[model samples]
Target: MNSGRLTNFLIPLLAVLLGVIAGSIVMVISGYDPIAGYSALLYGAFGDSYYIGETIRQMTPYILSGLAVAFAFRTGLFNIGVEGQLIVGWLAAVWVGVAFELPKFIHLPLAILAAALAGALWALIPGFLKARFKVHEVIVTIMMNYIALHVTNAIIRFVLSDKSYKSEEIHESASLRSEFLQSITDYSTLHYGIIIALIAAVIMWFLLEKTTKGYELRAVGFNQHASHYAGMNVSNNIVLAMVISGAFAGVAGAMEGLGTFANISVKAGFTGVGFDGIAVALLGGNNAFGIILSALLFGALKVGALEMPSSAGVPTELVDIVIALIIFFVASSYLIRLLLTRVKKEGK
Candidate 1:
């Protein structure tokens, strides 16, 4: 590969290696066996069909959430409000699933569509503010997360559930759960959401790499003033970017509601999936295929962490620390790149 591509690939790999090393150090200091811990983790995540199925299930949402963040990054927008968009999308999806009854073909797509629209509308607030008023998106999205949490919770209690903590179970027609997938994977919660996630990835790749509008979005991201001078509609592009980003996040929520849980519950706090998407996007270099790989790595780590406590006598929380370290290294990749450049110069 060319030097640029090589560097792009090496950065995330190096970050993962450093994070693993750092995690091993922590394990040793904590009186745990790092090899045993990691072995158990691997076995837990991929030892059998069941674990593999579960890992794929977990990866479903991670992929979409990563896409959500990556898409906004490509368009010069920081969509920190993915969490809020996801929550509203989840609520909207579940409401449609519960409130409607129709053929499987229509009901399922309708619910998913509702989720995408809800997320788009939620994201539109900050997008419009950024485009029209020149307001910063970071602050608005952060506040909107809290708004989504409480508002969804209240709606579930009063409107959807008749003062219950969760909404009614969705109709079978609206479910994404697949009997064939479940049976093949030893009845694991694997669903058809993975298909949607993969399709979304392809869509992002095509939109960002193959289309004229994609060129405009990336150009705007690189230099808005130049893009405007080139006759691009920078304002509309900004809003459109956020809308597309939110749509991705909303589908992520639908994976949970219509596939994993088959309903929505009152969440006391954020799901953290949206926040994790930020790290996923960063580690993936905001690339589509890279995001899928990173999401799988994260999914394996999470699923394997559950096995660590039982088999290796390690705390599952250690995996969280490792993830944090990975993100830290990724965020500090400028230093890593500088070091690599110096090494190359010295070698020459």
Candidate 2:
């Protein structure tokens, strides 16, 4: 690899090594077998086909959510409302999925598109305020999150509520379940969503790296004043960025509802997927390919956490501790750079 690419890879690799060493120290202090715990974590994440399927399932949403946050960041926006946008998107997709009786060819795509549009519209509120009134997107997005929560809850009560917290299942025709794949996997929830997520990631990479519109949007993101002076429509780009980010978040919701839950539900609180997206985006270096790998890594950690407490006698919370440490190290990028520079100087 080239020098920059090599450095990027090495940084994350070093951070991961540091995280593991730190986790090991915690395990030792706790009088646990660090070796055993590490082994279990690895096995739990990838020991079998079933576990691999679950990892993919979790990664699917993580990928989209990561993209949601990363997309906004590329445009100089911090979208904290991913959780709310995702929830609303799920509700909208399911609502439309069951409400209509269109053919599968049309209904499936319609449901997905509906969620994307819903998410985009919801995001527009903040975008509009920012563009028109110079309101801070962070504050507006945070407020929009609560608004989305209450609005979705109210809608569930009025429109989709049964005795259960969940809405009625989407029509079979509207569902995105891969019966054939499930049958092969003995009914694991793994579906075609993974493929969809990868496709979306590729498209995002192309959009951001190879398109003129992307150039304009990122130009605005880097320097709105300069972009406007250069005759680019800065306001329009800002709104467009949020809409695109929201659309990705909406797809995350749709994946949950259609591929996993099959309906909207009254969540106990915020889903936290949107918040997780922030970490995922940061860990992935806010790049499309990086986000996919980061999502998978986090997904594996989550899947492994469930088994750690039960099978390895390590508290599941340890996984969080490891993840937090990883993020902490990543956020402190200068540390990695310094370490790399030191290594180079010493070698020379």
Candidate No. with top lDDT: 1
- Expressed as tens digits, the lDDT of each residue in 1-348 for candidate 1 is 999999999988998888888888988998999999889989999999999999999999999999999999998888888888889999999999999999999999999999999999999999999999999999999999999999999999999988989899999999999999999999999999999999999999999999999999999999999999999999999999999999999999999999999999999899988998887888888999999998998888778778988999887677667657766776676688889999999999
Per-candidate Cα lDDT values, in order, are 0.91, 0.85
Tell me model 1's lDDT, rounded to 2 decimals: 0.91
Per-candidate TM equals 0.97, 0.93
Give the distance in Å from residue 215's predicted Cα in candidate 2 to where it truly belongs: 0.6
After superposition, the stretches of candidate 1 with alpha carbons farther than 4 Å from their true spots are 345-348
Residue 71, model 1: lDDT of 99
True-structure Cα RMSD, model 2: 2.1
TM-score of model 2 vs. true structure: 0.93
Model 1 lowest lDDT segment of ten: 322-331
**Deviation from truth (RMSD, Å), model 1:** 1.3
Per-residue error (Å), model 2, residue 73: 1.3
